[model samples]
Target: MEGNHSAHGAFILLGFSDRPHLERILFVVLLTLVGNTTIILVSRLDPHLHTPMYFFLTHLSFLDLSFTTSSIPQLLYNLAGHDKTISYAGCAVQLCLSLGLGGVECLLLAVMAYDRFVAVCKPLHYMVIMHPQLCLGLVSLAWGCGVANSLIMSPMTLWLPRCGHRKVDHFLCEMPALIRLACVNTAVVEGIAFILAVGIVLSPLAFILVSYGYIVRAVLSIQSSSGRHKVFNTCGSHLTVVSLFYGNIIYMYMQPGASASQDQGKLLTLFYNIVTPLLNPLIYTLRNKEVKGALRRLIWGNLHLRKTI
Candidate 1:
C-alpha cells in the first residue's frame, strides 16, 4: 500500500521549539560533535595507542560522530527556527541512519567488552587472540548488523498509516515518536520493534555483563593491587559507557513509550544522543592512562614541530 502522505510531506519536529531557551542545546550538540571528532582524530594520529582496544575506541568515536550528526543538526535547526518542518524523505533517512548507528554502537560496546575480557583474562594471548583480521571481522560484523536492523525497522515504521499526523514530538525522528504518530493499530509493528529493541539493546547488554563477570573473576585472582588497578582502569571507561547507553535505551523502549512523558522522553533522548557522546571521550581519556599519555604526546609533538617550522 502506498503511503497517503506525499514524499514532500513535512514533519514538524517539536524539538525544543516549545522551550524559550534553545541556545544551550545547540551549544551542547556542537560541542559534543567536536569532542567526538577529536577523539576519532586522536585515536588515529597516535601510533603508540594503536592497539585492539583503541582501535575499537576509534570505531566507537566514528559511530558516535555519525550517529549524532545524523539527527542533531536538524534538531538544532528546529530548535533555532520557527520553521521546524522536516521533509518526509529527510525524516526517513534520519530514522534509518540514527537507528543503524545506534544499533552498531550497542553491539560494538559488547565487542569492546569482550576485547577487555580477553586482555584481562588472557594477557599473554591478547595479541594473538584479538588479531588484525579478527578485529576487522568483528567491526565489520557490527556495522553489517546495524545496517541490517535499520533496513528492517525504518521502512516498516515509515510505511505506517500516519494519516497525515506528522508532528514528531521529539527533537529527532526517533522510532518511538514516529511510531506514536501512526494512525492504524500498531501492535504488530510495535511488537517487532520491541523484539528488535531486545535484540539490539538487551542482548548486547547481557553480553557486556557476562564479559565483565569473567573480567571480575580474573581481577580477583590477581594478587598485586597495582595489577588489579591497572586492569580496572582499562575496563572502567567502557563499563561506564555501556551503563549510560543501555540504561536510557532499556528505559525508553521498555513498553512502547509508556515510561516517560513526551517532554521527558525528549530529555532522555537528548542525554543519549548528546550527553553520552560528549562524555565518552572524557571518560576514556581521563580514566585511562594510555589514552591520556597518547593525547599529551600528540599535543606536545605538534607544538615541537611548530617550533621547528
Candidate 2:
C-alpha cells in the first residue's frame, strides 16, 4: 500500500503495534520478559531437575519458548522492517509451530495432571510407575505429535484456494483464521481437525479427570482433617492451571458459529495462547517446595564456592 503497491505477493502482519513509539516500547518489554524466563528456566537444569515433576516442567518451559518464538519474533520483524509482508513459507511455519505447540501443551498438561494425581493418590507406587523411561517417552511423544501435526495441518490449511483477500487478522496464522481464508469446502478440514483434537485433547482430559477423581477419593479417605487439607493444598495449584487452560480454550472453540465476534475471538486467543504459557512455569515451580529448595541451595552453593575461592 505504501511504496510497492502491486510488488509484493505476501500480506503484512501489522501485529500489536502500528504507532512507532508504542512498538519500540512493547518490543523492549516483551523481549526482556521472554529473555528472563528463558534464562531462569535453562539455568535450573541440574541433578535436582531429575524428578518426574521437574522433568515435565523442563519440557513445559521448552514448549513455552517455542510457542512464543513461533509468534513473537515474526511480529518483531514486521514491526522493525519496512516491508511487513511474510512469505507463504514463513506463514506456513507460523501456523505449524503455533498449532503444534498448542496441541503439545494440551497433552502435556494432562500428563502433568496425571503425574500430580499419582503423586497424591498413589504415592506408594509413584516411583515404580512414573519412571525415567516412561517420562522420556511421554515428553518425546509430545514433541513428535507437534512435529507430525505441523506436517499435516500446515499444508492442509495453506494449500487451500486463495480466491479472495489474503490478509490474516491475527499476528500469526491460526487454524480458524487460516481455515476461514481457505477457498476449499472446509467440511473435511473441520471434521478431521475436530476428530483429531477431540482424540488428543478430550481423551487426555478425560483421563486427567479420572485421575483427579481418584485423587479426590483418596484425599477423602484420609481420616485426619489436617491430612486432607495438606493433600488439597498440594494439588490446588495444578487444578487451577488445568481449569484456566481448558476453560479459555473451550470458551473460544465451543462457541456457536453464528456468534463469531472478532473482538471476543482476539481476547480469548490472548488469554489461552499468550497468557497461559507464561504462567505455567511460575505457578508450578512456586507451588512446589522441592524446586524452591533446590533453587535456594543452588544459589547458596555458588555463593559459597565464590567465597571459598
Candidate 3:
C-alpha cells in the first residue's frame, strides 16, 4: 500500500492556473495544433518536398506535433476546468514521451547541421555522402539516443521519494519540476541530469557549432557575394531554430542544481514548447521558395479537386 501510494501518485499540474486568461491558453493551443498539422500535411503531400532537408523537416514537425500533443491537450483540460490532476502513469508517459521528443530534436538539429555542412562544403559529394541509407541511419541514431535517454531518466525521476508532495508547479511533468517535488537531496540526480544534458544538449550543440564553423569558412571561400548570400539564406532558418531550441534548453538544464524562478522557467517553457514549434513551419515555409511552391501547388490542387467535384 505504501509502495502503491508512493509509486502510483497523481500530480496536480498548476500550469498557468494563477493567470486569469483561460481563453488565451486555449488560443495558443489552437495555434500550435494548426501550425504543426499544416507542416506535416504539406510535407507529406507535396512531392516537391521530397529532398533530404524536407525529410528531416517533416520528421521535426512530426516530433513537435507529438511533443506538443503529449502535454498541451491535458494542459487545455486543466486550464479550462477545476481539475488539474494527472494520473501517475499518465505523468510518467508524458515525461518519457516529451523528453524523448525533445532529446530527439536536439540530436536531429545537429544531424541537420551536418547535412547542411555536407551540402555546403562538399557540394560535389553531397548526394553521394547524404544518401538515403546514411540519412536513415542518422535519423534512427537521433531517435534511438533520445528514447534511450528518456527510458533511463523518466523512471528514475518517477521513483524519487516525493514525501507526499503531489503538486507539480509547472504545466508538465518535466524532469526539473518533478525533481523539485522530491523531499530528499537530489544532488546525485542533478549531477546525472547535468551529464545527460551535456551528452544530449551540449555535445550536439558543440558539433553544430563546429559544423557551422566549417560551413561559414566554405561559404566565405566563394568569391561571389551572390553565391555567399544563397548559401547563408539556405542555412539561416536552421540556425534560428537551433538558437531558439538550444539556448533555452542549455540555460535550463546545464546547471541542474540552480533553481530558476518559477515564473521565468514557465515563460521559457512556454517559448520552447508552444511558441517555437508554432514558429517552425512559418520559418521554413516562408524562407524557402520550394516550400512556398509546394504550398501553392497543394492549395491549387485542392481547389481544383473541389471544383471538379
Candidate RMSDs in Å, in order, are 1.8, 4.3, 1.8
* Candidate 1 local distance difference test against the native: 0.84
> Best TM-score goes to which candidate?
1
List, in order, the clash count of every candidate structure. 0, 0, 0
If both were scored by lDDT, which would come out higher, candidate 2 or candidate 3?
3
Model 1 segments more than 4 A misplaced = 1-3, 6-8, 257-260
TM-score of each: 0.95, 0.84, 0.94
User: Which tens-of-lDDT digit does each residue in 1-309 have in candidate 2?
Assistant: 422332224755654443455455434435435643653554465576677876776677677667666776777777766766787778877778877887787788788888888888788999998998999888888778767766776677776665644676666666666666555577776666666667666777787789889998888788999888767665776787788777765554444122355446555565565566667656765775666666777778889999999
Best-to-worst order by TM-score is 1, 3, 2
217, model 1: CA deviation in Å? Answer: 0.7
Residues 155-244 of candidate 1: C-alpha lDDT, one tens digit per residue? 988888877687888878888888888878888887887899889888998999999999999999999999999988888888999888
Q: For candidate 2, what is the lDDT? A: 0.68
lDDT of 3 by residue, 79-187 (tens): 6789989999889999999779889999999999999999999999988999999999999999999999898888888898887789988888888888888878889
Which 10-residue window of candidate 2 scores lowest in summed lDDT?
1-10
Question: What's the true lDDT of residue 308 in model 2?
Answer: 100
